[model samples]
Target: MCARIIRSLLVVCASLAVAANASAGQVQVAVAANFTAPMQAIASEFEKDTGHSVQASYGATGQFYAQISNGAPFEVFLSADDSTPAKLEKEGQSVEGSRFTYAIGKLVLWSPKEGVVDDKGAVLEKGDFKHLSIANPKAAPYGLAATQTLDKLGLSDTLKGKIVEGQNITQALQFVSTGNAELGLVALSQVYKDGQITAGSVWVVPEAMYQPIRQDALILKKGADNPAAEALVEYLKGPKAAEIIKAYGYTL
Candidate 1:
């Protein structure tokens, strides 16, 4: 009788998965640049667990913010900073009571090879390198943090001409990885993943060097009942996702 009941439960669960998949609603997500890797993992895992599909667009947090404010139909937002998500909540762009931090990002001075940048966020200060890449400060949280770090060290004025701006942190990292730029300011996660491959040398910048990169996620006003969006967001805060976040060198 017990075995029969277990078989019936499995049948019911399979039927539910099929029904949920058949009726699954589509969700559009706007993710922060720094979160690309982890978000990809989360998206894959969420789909496997819930039998749902989601579409994502990634960009600089500020750029996404501009798009959202301009009527982009994003059903979820993963912000690179706390302020923007909080502001979106205030402006009613997101569902009330559905915002929270998903990760604490780590900024780094990254190069294609080791020894390119010695200790200190001082590599750009010398201005000898051919090119230094950073995300556009006006539209990327990591870029803004890079600028703030340069300013605090009194090097912004000198490095100003050597800088190349990318639309997002991922692009900025690409500039260095492709050797178009000798070095870049980037998020730590891009350099390493648990089971994936990457190449780079990175100095994880200390938190004191800049304000925290508190990445936040939320269900948008249109995504109040989006199971995929909610599941992905909730999954990120759970044990499986937390392990992946840490493995990529984020703090939490």
Candidate 2:
């Protein structure tokens, strides 16, 4: 009887997945730049598992928030900070009660050159590097955290001239990766994953150096009636997606 029940449950689950695919189409997602890699992986797996496609646009979370406020046709938003989604929900731009924390991001001070940045983040004080890249503090959550970190270290003013700002974290990473900047304050997921540094050297910033970066996701008003959008959002909360996210070095 137990074997029969298990078989029946499998059939039901398969039927549900098929039905979901038949009913939904493609979901347009606005994702924070820091989450680009993992979201791409998650989207690919989600398409394979459920046959629902995702079209993702990655940029600074604040820029996406502004665009959404001005009627961007994004079906869903994956913000780098929790407050943006909450504000959208309050403004009726997103589906109420649809906001949920998806990842807890970690900040890192990274340098493409090995051993250039120590674990204690003493590189900033050394000031030997010609340039330090950071995302636009006014527009990116990671940038804001970088700003707070610099302030906490009392280097905000002293390092002003050495700083180069990128429009988003992706660009900031590019600045450092291509040797345009000696180092950068970037998202940890961008440089490290699966318990190893993907490239270069890194100083993982202490959590107390800045505010918690609790990233969140929400179904936008434009996606309220989109079955694909809702399905994609739900899929992100599933174990498969969580595994992908954690593999990228983000905490659940």
Model 2 C-alpha lDDT per residue in residues 1-252, reported as the tens digit of each score: 999999999999999978876875898999999999999999999888768799999999889988998888999999999988888989889888889999999999999888899989998998998999999988899999999999999999999999999999999999998989999999999987777999888999999999999999999999999888889989999999999899888999
Provide the overall lDDT of each model, using Cα atoms, as 2-decimal numbers: 0.83, 0.93
Winning model by TM-score: 2
In candidate 1, what are the lDDT values of residues 70-155, reduced to their tens digit? 98889899998999999999998898888998888878888888676777756666677988899998888899989987887788
Q: Give the TM-score of candidate 2.
A: 0.91
Q: How many angstroms is residue 180 displaced in model 1 relative to the true structure, after the best TM-score fit?
A: 1.8
lDDT of 2 at 80: 94
Which RMSD values do the candidates have, in order? 3.8, 5.4
**Residue 210, model 2: Cα distance from true site in angstroms:** 0.4
* Model 1 accuracy (lDDT, Cα): 0.83
Best by lDDT: 2
